[model samples]
Target: MQTSSFIGAVDIMSTQTATERPILHGGRREAMREAYPAAPQPWIDLSTGINPIPYPIPTLPAECFTRLPDPEAATRLESIAAAAYHVSDAAMVAAAPGTQILIELLARLLPQQRIAILGPTYAEHQAAWARGGGSVDLIPDLDDLPAASSLVLCNPNNPDGRIIPPARLRALADHLAARGGLLVIDEAFADLADRATSMAATLPHPAIVILRSFGKTYGLAGVRLGFALADAPRAAAIRTALGPWAVSGPAIAIGTIALADPAWLAATQHRLTHAAATLDRLLTDAGMTIIGGTPLYRLAATATAPDWHDRLARAGIMTRRFDDHPSWLRFGLPADHTAWARLAAALSGNRPPLANHPDQ
Candidate 1:
């Protein structure tokens, strides 16, 4: 299989003699709000696969606001995460504001190495590597990956939500290890349902690093806490790269509580499982194909994905649509049945009841 080169706005400068181009519109909340104005009831935000029902956040102690967190607070959070993931306490876990920070840190730490990335996945992984001065080879298939110094992949990949089997991923990791190459698994969404399938539980396989994020699973993206798990030395190396006090006090407090609550985890999993199945059936019944996903979200594609996205947005519903693959769309399971009905009606070309409202 031939690999396509991963290009970003920066690469555009290399080809064009022009000095500047229009600033790219980032998908920040402000921009999204402007592009899709909120309706009276608020637009349904299903663009992200974050948990619709986030772990309940408790009021923090006065110290959380009074001063910086004690160093031990981060350590305690790491310990809780390690136990939750069934990894060794000595595995060298460190928290950052989000997994994106960890990915950037890893990229900087491994600068000058040739990086191989699975494409049409998270744009940030490739962006981070490129920004850190690493040469990237974007491979479409695992077998097509070149013998590179580093590899990065998003398990249950984004946009399409296809999961690379754990056993197969391990075999690939072993292969990279044999070649003195590092394999980095971004398991940001793996906790949506399958924990046993995560490589993070048993990593530091000489050349393996795993990233886990609390944002998607616990719906704490606002708090922004995530972890990097590896063998002691590599973990220590990544920690050194991040330096001290990277995670905020509120993030540490919330992440620790969320990871430790097994009951919440179980309940969230059950909810997502049922919701995902329902979403799959609804899309299928509407003539769209539910091609892939885990329990967190469904990946569907039809000749209508682009138009459907526009139609839904006009109906006061927001969803994720991919530009690179115009036919594909990702839908996060809404917490309420009413939202699902709105989505189903939109997909079926039925005007939402609210369409007749004067406000709409």
Candidate 2:
């Protein structure tokens, strides 16, 4: 079923001039502190796509702190990651401190070439490639990808959750391969998306590089771990650029255990699914049209997004607002019953929480 089906339809219209629109912000707690110093205590942040309820970290051995990240342990982590992410083999996976770092590293590793990115997605891809001296183009259609030497896209894309099929992407990869070009697929939110939406299962493609985020799915963003999966040569090049001890010892140990835990993975999926449905109802009731987003976040549209953002901010509930699209707001799932209640109250102009909505 469509994620949008849970929400009611709302007509979104805007009358304000560009300059009159208020910028709604949410991400870092420090940013929240700066923007709304007197708003409320213990801010409820929904700005980021990272999971609010993080995985329970296992107790660490003392050696994880005192010892350098062992290569063998790192290798085992890679093996587990490959299995978890559905990549063809462990040899195809390269671990990095975070996918953000890999974005920059991969951009630098590539030859300066024209790049096309699937649009209105993550801003970092454009920024990273631009810094590497590659010309960037944001194209709306998948057919346009073959025109650029390098193509970058987020599967079940960020901000707006758009997932292109694996077969069509494989065709694009083949076209790029023939031209000696590259296809960078950021599967950052694929874990909660339609499982088939991921291209990892069809990997070992010479031209395609699949990027996965451990922290986003596992809720350990601070752990500083991510993976880059590609054909042998590209994976080798990425590893060389990242160098030794690239991921922290603590990260390796945690990742080894977490990546192998299928039971927790399944339960988290179910939990996020219900939470996303609940969020959709809340946003729709507040007069927003459901846009699209992965389970990690929901994008909604309304003429008064800025006003809603302001109201929520005043109540110390920070959500994501888009600069380009003044009518859009993206919300992350609330961490707990209290957060959910707070978000519902904030959206309703700080009224008492709706009694109908039960804790997930």
Candidate 3:
């Protein structure tokens, strides 16, 4: 659902959907409002890959809010995260506010190293590397990767769910390591993905740094917790760069409990799977070609993508429209039945009656 007014513009929409779709903040909401001035009162924001259903946050101790974050609490969070991510040692996992920070940190650590990023993935990887002074190449083909100091990519890639196999990754890792470089895998979207393909399951490697996102998976993007998994020495380097008390007290408390709860993760995974299936049916029904995406979102292609995007926007449904890939529109799952029905009607070109306005 396009909850356009959810975030920084939560005043324009409502606080409820903003909480539901936390990733889309006030600035984007305002931009959407400007883009579609006559858009409905509230939007069903499908612009982000964040899960609408958030983790059930347990009550926090008053200290979690009042006191400075403890080093021990941070350590506990890493340990629990290691077990949750199937990592061999907690020492190899360094916790940070978010993986976005870790991405830049990793790049800056080895500045001026030429980087090869598997293309059309997350734009952030390229941006971060470039900022860190690395000459970046956007490589599209997996058959032949350029010889760069590091190979940066996502596992189940963003925009297009092109998953590179572990055997292939191992070979790449070997090649990069032999060249005295690194293989950075952003497993940000891999929490709900296949565990068998995760690089986190293997022992920590000097050449491999697996970035993990906490907020996107748990639907608690506001809590702001992520990890960088690497060899102990490398992990220590990340921690040092992070300085003291980098992870907030609330984030520590929340992440510790969330990562420790397997039952909730499993239940949420099932729910997201069902939501993705429903979304797939809805998109296909509306004559859109399913291009790619993980369970959290679907990438659809249509010759009339611009028209479709405008139509949906007018009807208060905000799907992701890429400037580069104008034919592509990424749809995050509709949060509720009203959002679902509205999306369906909009996509089908059957605007709901004014009498049915509330749900329509």
TM-score of each: 0.87, 0.89, 0.89
Model 1 / residue 83 / CA error / Å: 0.8
lDDT, candidate 3, 164-229, per-residue tens: 899888888888889889899989899898887789877576689999999988988888889999
Model 3: how far residue 329 lies from native, Å: 0.5
Cα RMSD (angstroms) for every candidate in the order listed: 6.8, 7.8, 7.5
Q: What's model 1's lDDT at 42? A: 60
- lDDT of residue 113 for candidate 3: 72
Q: What's model 1's overall lDDT?
A: 0.73
Indicate the TM-score of model 1. 0.87
Worst 10 residues of 2 by lDDT: 2-11
lDDT of 1 by residue, 90-197 (tens): 446877789979888888886647988887677777777777888888888888888688899888777567778888888888888887888888888888646667
Model 2 global lDDT (CA atoms, 0 to 1): 0.81
lDDT of 2 by residue, 1-360 (tens): 111211111111122222344222246666556666777878888878888999999999999999998899998999999999888789999999999899888889986489988877776677778778887777878866546897999998878898888888999899888989998999999988777999998878889999999999899998999999998788888988999999999999999999999899899999999899999999988778998988888999877666676677777887776656767888999999999999887777433233322321
Worst 10 residues of 1 by lDDT: 1-10
